[model samples]
Target: MAAATHAAAGRVSGASTSELGAAPRPAPPAIQRVRRRRRPSGEAPPLPRHLATSGKLWLALSGVVLAVWAVVFVTDSIAYVDVADTRILQAVAEVRSDPLTQVAEVAGGLATSGAIHVIWLVNLVVLVLVRRWRHLFVWLVTGLVVVNLTAVAAAMLQRPRPFEVEIIGRWSGFSMPSLPVTVLATFLVSTLYALVPAGRPREIGKWVVCALLAATAASRLYLAQDHPTDVVTSVVLGVAVPLAAFRLLTPNEVYPVRYRRGRPAHLDVTGARGAAIVRALQDQLGVVATKVAPFALSGSGGSTPLRITVRAHPSAAAEESCVFGKLYAATHVHSDRWYKLGRTLLYGRLEDEKPYHSVRRLVQYEDYVLRVLWDAGLPVPHPMGIVEITPEREYLLVAEFVQDAVEIGDAEIDDAIIDQGLSVVRRLWEIGMAHRDIKPANLLVRDGTLFLIDPAFAEVRPSPWRQAVDLANMMLVLALRTDAARVYARARKQFSDEEIAEAFAATRGLTMPSQLRRMIRAQGRDLHGEFLALLPYQLPPVPIQRWTLRRVGLSLITVAGLALAVAVGVDLVGSPL
Candidate 1:
């Protein structure tokens, strides 16, 4: 009936009867789709508050107690005298015949010198297997220090071991903190760490270790080999020293637990490898660097590679000093291979990109290229020498730092600056080379001369298209920073109207350097409109075939890599034989 009435009304209103007669369609069902959370790259979970502060408090408290104990031991103060040793020894002597005492004696005997040595060997093997270098270092150093400090403390106090019961085998040293108790506690802590990774397993392992530690400390007191106070102090030192050392040495970002150690080091300027490079530079370059410091930026403003500045004293007789160094490392270099491969799969080809082959080789190649440019009298940083930290893992390039130079992007760009930048492009092209990464950051102005900084992207006998990219990139950088009219005007002086058009045309399907692309995207304002407006001719956008032969080849390579990875995994896991 409603349909009939609706049809009559539609006829009256000159609407189609078919629409009115049609059955009303049911509403689409709502979907309860699940969405996974996405965190920004390199983001880490926030450290818990207790983990951030607890270690320090524990360290301070233990340190204060130890200090008070040391003062009493040293000054022979009447307060808190050696009565603890007598009382504890008397208590333990009464329990000498108990079954628990016999059990503790057996356990203590098992935790002897031989057993402790075996435990250390086992811990070492586990740490090596897991590649826990940082943990291994902290474990070894803390153990050695604790042992020595305990010995020193016992000797200084000249405390005597308890004689209330049958003495443990070969006991001669004075007992301030029980050596066996200290060794057991520290060994348990370090051993559990090396054996288990963080998770439920580790949490359970930690509790087990804590129980073992308490038992071992109690055993020392039960056997009356040391006073109750001695065992208590030994346990405190064993735990506290490593905790303090961890807090001091390890970064909180790497580990959630404040005093947790054994994280890979973030190789920064202050690391062992970095210091070695600096020393190598001094020897090879024959210039003693009075001081080496990290420059706040050394890049184009975006997160490019990091460079270090060194203040070198050329001669002992001279007071004259100079700043000279190189842009050596970037955070990307650490994971460059995987990053480059992922990018290749997404984007067609990264031809101008650094060799995804290996970081050391890439760095070495850059050093070599910089030397070549310097030898050719091209305006670049004067090459000092290459510091090989690791043969195939790490490297450092030493070069003359342009002391009073300013980035082209930061500088007051004018017609003169634009002209000079263009001239750099032209000169490179004339010499059968291309500064493939012709970006504003790479171009620096010092004393009215434009000097190129990172020539890592330079290529010899490059294709005509590669040379054209250099031209377009130089123009693009200038146009983005300043007005296009000024750039176009300056460009016209060196390049013809048609030649300028050709340069812009060549950028159609060109693979831009990552740094240049990043800088352009990060710009607050777009320059493409201004660029088009200032163009002498409208060139058609070059059509890029998404699924070309190159892409197909890359796809096959990716498949092979995945297959090989699977095969290696199968081999590692083994068949269910």
Candidate 2:
């Protein structure tokens, strides 16, 4: 009864007692696994410790290498080491002259041969093995061949070598594009790619290899087998070929970065327009804004002077930027192109007389003439900006406006103006320059100081006849406004009447229409008579004929009109009687 009760209790409580018989707990149902949280896509894998350590080591090595190279460069400069062509020439001479030097020559030749062939073979083999890399292989091969050919062609041109020829051995090839130099360069580059690990240390290793290759190439020239230029060409071809090949093969390897060193990185603004320009400039350069201002005021081309204002950014603190402005004279719908006109009223006759087409080109031509005059040191306004009008109008030139200068048309011609004008003519002769358009508007007077202006028709050439004509034109223009005696007296003080005659004689050859001459003679009768009386000779016969014709024609017309008036008056009197 006691045993039966114990068994029953154990069964009911589900407790494990050292029982003879017990139902085994059913094995826990195969664990229903909980799902794990998914990681975000494109997450970076953790860097391996080995790679990180390697990179740090490489950076340290590169630092050390750069430091060493710097030291060597400085020391070499200070010590005056003749490691260039001169040293190499000396070594080559010693080797060639001495019988025992044959060993060294053979050794060098063997080394060069080995380096050149070995690298090429390796690259070719690797390219072949990489079956799907035909494009890369083709680019590499093509680049190498092109560079080699270029070097060879340049070498054959045979530019003189930097060093004196100390031919201890017979040298046959041209002194440029050294073949051995090319070989060494190509070999080192190709080998570096194959062997050097990719990191900072690898970069340093590459530089080291390059330096060694360069040194070896230079050695050949120093030995007198090649010229310095030849060796340089070889090195260039070697490096350029492989790098070009690599770029072609791995297009993604190209990393371009714009470097701005001493240039201003700020946008300069002077006004609203300038602000917009500054913003655009900033966007382009990826820099900040420094200052702003309204652009300088300049003149434009047209019959009416148009003023243009513009904003600009200086390239540097010391540099200036060139800006071109445009001005329209009228809203005329004559042509498809815009035309500009000069604002100064001085251009009124020109506008009325000349064909009104393609004025901007003409203005540009005038600007060019001004530049020529400026370069010749003539007293013309310093041109700063140019204004382009439309195709039908003239342009306005923005020049340094002579603030105090008086226009010759507005000023009285005193001895000072006369003397200054003569002096200008003399200077023009000295510089072999001629100002074709010598009018009153082209002359300026400042505080009794005279300056030649409007050199748009000036020419720079060695022609005394042309210069004489230029002087004659000036004298004629002056005579039109001033008393001829006064002008001649002033001009004669500096120039002989014979010289003046010679100038006038030269002027006669210039194309002046008979009609125009007649008109001018009628206008200048008083002026001409006074001038001729002062001179050693009478006025020219052609001018006298034109003057007489004009006078006779006027007298005949007057007589005819008077006769008609008398007849009409007599008839009226008879009717009254």
How do all models score by TM-score? 0.51, 0.32
Query: Which consecutive 10 residues in model 2 have the weakest lDDT in total?
Result: 22-31
Runs in model 1 lying further than 4 Å from the true structure: 1-266, 296-323, 327-334, 350-360, 508-510, 513-524, 542-553, 556-577
Q: How far out, in Å, is residue 414 in model 2? A: 1.2
Per-residue CA lDDT of candidate 2, range 242-323, in tens? 5454433322111111122211111112343334333332332222224333222111112222222222234334222222
Model 1 lDDT at residue 274: 48
The residue-level lDDT of candidate 2 at 494 comes to 51
Query: Which 10-residue window of candidate 1 scores lowest in summed lDDT?
Result: 22-31
lDDT of 1 by residue, 1-577 (tens): 6576445434433422222221111111111112323334564321211234656776776788788787876787723455656666676667676677678866676347766766766776767676655666677766676666666777777777765456543455777767767776677766655455545776798788777777766677676667777777777777777766654443332322212432232233444444655555554444444455555343433212334444423333445344444433332253454455556567655455443465566677777788776665567777666654444444556666665778777777766667667766666665678877777678777656667777766888887667877887888787767877788777655555555665666674245555566667788545555556777576665433345576678789989976874554333223110
